[model samples]
Target: MITLSLIGIGSGNPDHVTRQAEAAMNTAEVILIPRKGAAKDDLAELRRAICARVLRAPGPVVREFDLPVRDASGGYRAGVEAWHDAIAEVWAAELADALPEGGHAAFLVWGDPALYDSTLRIAERLRGRMPIEVRVIPGITAIAALTAGHAIPLNAVGGPVAITTGRRLREDGWPAGHDSVVVMLDAGQAFEAVDPEGVFIWWSAYAGMDDEIRIAGPLAEVAGQIAAARAEARARHGWIMDIYLLRRAC
Candidate 1:
């Protein structure tokens, strides 16, 4: 049987990597890194840096594989499912080749595996194709980091908060009964779609990382500023991972 460890190393910062995640990293015989072309190579580099910090000498055999791009021609959900299938195939082939004898392998995931991240779901796809068992080591989430970066609590006292993607937040507008919402995986400033009349926003790009940038204020006042900042950061870095919390006045 092939044992796979989905280790969350947090978002970008090596200091956020927990001892449990580090221990899990050392225990694996193979480590897989996904390459997302030149634009996002820093992601793979961060994973490597974390492994370098924790792995002992004569450590796990590390391998990098090109990640498949999501094909948007089939619509969002269908395209994501197809993309996951493609990723699973690459994973299965890489593991089979790396560990012909069947052993432990680990994939370094950003944030927690159980959060908005999909590494766990992709790993589940291997169950039918190979004899596999999966384990998770949780780490700090972008939400946790975002809140911490802003020195605010995740929710108000006895208030309802919802977590949703940028696409959903943009298309659905503020969820019906939610007083607060956390948005992730936004391709752009989805906040523009919101009414912004009585809402407040706390936005962060690369939260908890060394080069983190954050902006916060009444959405009406700072929405355009946040959009401009986000655009500048993304242009300079070639890529950006961001999350935000929005709260409506009581």
Candidate 2:
């Protein structure tokens, strides 16, 4: 059986790696790192760096694979499904080649696999077909990192917080009942979808990384600055991963 460990490294910061994740990394027979192409090469590099730091004893082997690009011709959901299928195929091929003996392999995920990530779904697809055993090591999520960076609580006392994506906010507007929302996977400038009145926003880019940037205030007052900063950061880094928290005054 192939033991696959989905370890969360936490927002691309070496220090954010938990001791459990470190132990898993050290114990794996092979570790697969996905390359998101040149634009996001730094992501793969960060994974490598984490391995370098945590795998000091180095019993595990590290390998990198080119990630399949999503087909945008179809609608978003369909495209994503196709992309996940392709990723699964790549994982199967790579695992077969690397671990002929059916040993343990690990993949370093950016955040907790249970949070807005498809690693678990893809791992399910690999089960039964490959005789695989899946394990997860949860780490800090982008929302937690963003909130910590801004030194702000995620919600008001006795209040609810809705975690959502940029597409959802753009298509559905503010979710009912919850005044506070944490948005992730936003390309940039998703705040425009909201009414902006009485809305407060705390935004962070590269939350746990050294080059972190943060902006928080009334949405109307600092939306422009957040947009400009996000644009500049993306231009400089070729890609950016960010999360923002919005609270509408009840």
Candidate 3:
């Protein structure tokens, strides 16, 4: 049987790693890290740094694998499904090679697995192929970092908030019945699609990291600045991970 631990390491900050996650890393027989590409090498490096900090000498065996790139050519949903299947296959092969006898293996997840991350779904695909037991250790989410970074409350007292993706905001407009919206996975800066008249935006890139950047103001006054800033940051870093909160006038 394979004991699979999906440990959340938080948003690129080594200090964000919890004691539980640290203990799990030290106890696991193998830890698998995924290298997305040169552009996102810093992400993989963060995982490695976590291991270096927590794992003792002569500790668990460390393994690295290349992650499958998602195909965005077809419909978004269809492409994502295909990409997940590809990732599951890669994961199975790597795990099997690392533990031919079936042992404890861990994957350090970015942020919490229960959130927008797909590591949980990919792990589910391995159940039929092997006798596996899965465990999750939650970590601080990007939303939390964004809010904390800006020193703002997540919701107005007794008001509702919707957490969604950039694609949804652009394609569907703002969701109904929520005073505030927290947008994630917005590669295209979907905030530009909304009417900026009464909305306030608090945006952050690489939240909680050393090079973290933040911007907040009325949407109309600063939407262009946010866009320009995002462009510049992505150009400088080669990749960017960002999230934002939009609150409509009460």
Candidate 4:
């Protein structure tokens, strides 16, 4: 049996990686890093840097594998499990090649595994097919990064906050009765569909990263600006990860 450790590396900053996370990485027999093509090669590079910075010379066997991204516009929803299953297969094949003797394998995860991320779910799928033990080393979350970067509280005093995806906000509309909402994994334009009245937005792209960008203002005024900036950044970097907090006028 292989011991699979899911180590959260935090949002996008090397400093965000905790000591515990580093310790976990040092102990693993094999560490898997996913290369997301050329556009997002920097992400993989960051993982490499983190490993190089934390691990001693002749560290755990580091291996890179191509990561399969979800098709955002897959026709009529082919289902998430379909995509996750494919990822699990890739992971298994890579691990079988790297750790034929069933040793410890570490998966470096971005952001917290329990929040909005899918590494845990994919691991669950792998467990169904293999005899592997799973361990999670929690790290900082993007939501926390967004809030801290903006230097603002996540919720107003005694008020409720709803955390959701851009798709939900666009398809379901702003959740009623929630004065504050945190959105992650947005398609970068969902705020356009929102009712701008009384809404304030704090938007950040690549939050907590070296190339981080931030914009904030009344939603009515900055909605277009955010969209344009997001598009330009994605074009410039070939990829972007962003999060935003929306609060109704109190």
- The top-ranked prediction according to lDDT is 3
TM-score of 1: 0.98
For residues 157-240, could you state the per-residue lDDT of candidate 4 as single tens digits?
999999999988999999999999999889747888888999999999998898989999999999889989998999999999
User: Relative to the unseen true structure, what is the C-alpha lDDT of residue 62 in candidate 4, on a scale of 0 to 100?
Assistant: 94
Using TM-score as the yardstick, the better of models 1 and 4 is 1
Candidate 3 regions exceeding 4 Å error are: none
lDDT tens string, model 3, 62-123? 99999889988889899999999999999999988999998999999988999999999999
Relative to the true structure, candidate 4 has a C-alpha RMSD (angstroms) of 1.4
Q: Sorted on lDDT, highest at the top, how do the candidates line up?
A: 3, 1, 2, 4
Model 3 worst lDDT window (10 residues): 42-51
How do all models score by TM-score?
Answer: 0.98, 0.98, 0.98, 0.96
lDDT of 1 by residue, 119-147 (tens): 98899999989999999999999999999
Please, what's the RMSD in Å of model 3? Answer: 0.8
Assess candidate 3 and give its TM-score to the true structure.
0.98
Q: List the residue pairs that clash in candidate 2.
A: none
TM-score of 2: 0.98
Candidate 3 lDDT (Cα, 0 to 1): 0.94
